[model samples]
Target: MEPNDQPAPLLEGRFEGRNDFIQLVRDALGVAAQAGWRELILSDSNFYDWPLGERAVIDSLNAWARGGRQLTLLAKSYDEVVRRHPRFVAWRATWGHIIQCRACPNADALDVPSMIWSSDWVMQRLDPVRSVGVAGTEAGRRVAARELLREWIENKSAPGFASTTLGL
Candidate 1:
């Protein structure tokens, strides 16, 4: 099936604490992979360090990419992420064709929380200061987040992975 470009209304809920956030992201990734989702979009500064630091998460992501899934990451601190998260860096290196990353210079000023979108599902950390976040299959919210991600990618200059020498 082709990816849906239409916006869907967002259904929202909250996750409190690091464990809850990690499980939410893990479950969402599994669902997306099982459903053969074509596109996965993530915007975060340090997601590779906290919740997604596990080896299983990295392996799952690699498997999904190997299955022809496409991933776009709009990261705020790409450099730091690579330095701290070797697993993620290695995964990106191995699946550079399926995964593409862009750096958002205005991420801090935007104060956007980390978000993951797959198919119709979305999980977002609404507050940066707290571990609280909202996750749901609300179509509208997913579309809004996707649009914001698109805007960030378009407006910022691409930090070519080649220049970073991360081999991504």
Candidate 2:
């Protein structure tokens, strides 16, 4: 390996197709757990198409669910998630202490980027319909991706997506 090569080669660069998107999400979660990344941020309009319910993702998440590590989910709405990602919903309930979910109801759906971000890697779907986007470890691109996610979460969202609800 070159001196600069990452210990684990990432599925880096532009990717197109739904299969690629799902694979990238899975790969990121697996790598994050193995690398002990400090945090992960997932943002989407509604996560209507993400593969968060898969068993492999749950396994990686289970591995990543240790103390002091944080995971945040930002979305215009999680209704789709609740409906589509039942496995993820169950996992979130078990790891609620380390997971934070935010709702961006007022933000335009089109303005919200569909992406997953971590200190070491990021994948963003520039065109959600086609599942086309880019992912990599390029420092400048990672910085920019982090900035965009932070802006939407801090400025346009609020506490939401409770793990449980009480029917009065």
Candidate 3:
């Protein structure tokens, strides 16, 4: 069945606390899939707190996967991710063809804003430690968010987090 155009639900908020932020991340993914956002981008330091390993998150990602869709993830290091998020690693391996995973190493030590960016929406943890930030669909927010991360995604980051490691 063709997916309906009806959006999932509004998820915009200025969230505080870890649980609230996690809920926003989860809700945003569901909305992103439902709305059929074409490009999904996530930038984080290490993704220590994201729910990427959860089954529900994977389900939403599956729904969102299709031709012409692209997903990108930027991080400083994936060591913590590898240690903490096995499910997401598996998912990434399977979906590697559709994902672009990159790293900011060395002097590119930008304080990568922890955020989720879709074609029409944005959610960022402005103070990640406090789990406090904003999520919205306004054009200004979307544009500013895009501009803030586009440079790193395009120029500063290097290929990272291999979908499948090879050794012999």
lDDT of each: 0.69, 0.89, 0.85
Q: Any runs in candidate 3 off by more than 4 Å, and if so which? A: 1-5, 107-110
On a 0 to 100 scale, what is the lDDT of residue 18 in model 1? Answer: 72
Model 3 score (lDDT): 0.85
TM-score of 3: 0.92
Estimate the TM-score of every prediction.
Answer: 0.80, 0.92, 0.92
Kindly give the stretch of ten consecutive residues in candidate 3 with the minimal lDDT sum: 1-10
Shift in Å, residue 2, candidate 1: 24
RMSD of candidate 1 to the truth, in angstroms, is 5.6
Question: Which order, best to worst by lDDT?
Answer: 2, 3, 1
In model 3, which residue pairs have backbone atoms overlapping below 3 Å?
A: none
Give a tens-digit lDDT track for model 3, residues 1-168: 256568666567787899988888888888777777889999998899998888999888888886678999999888888998898899889889999998987533338779998768899888988888998889999989998889878877899999999999
Look at candidate 2 and tell me the lDDT of residue 78.
96
Descending-TM-score candidate ranking: 2, 3, 1
Per residue, candidate 2 scores C-alpha lDDT tens digits across 53-127 of 999999989988885899999999999999999999999999999999999888888778899999888899999
TM-score of 1: 0.80
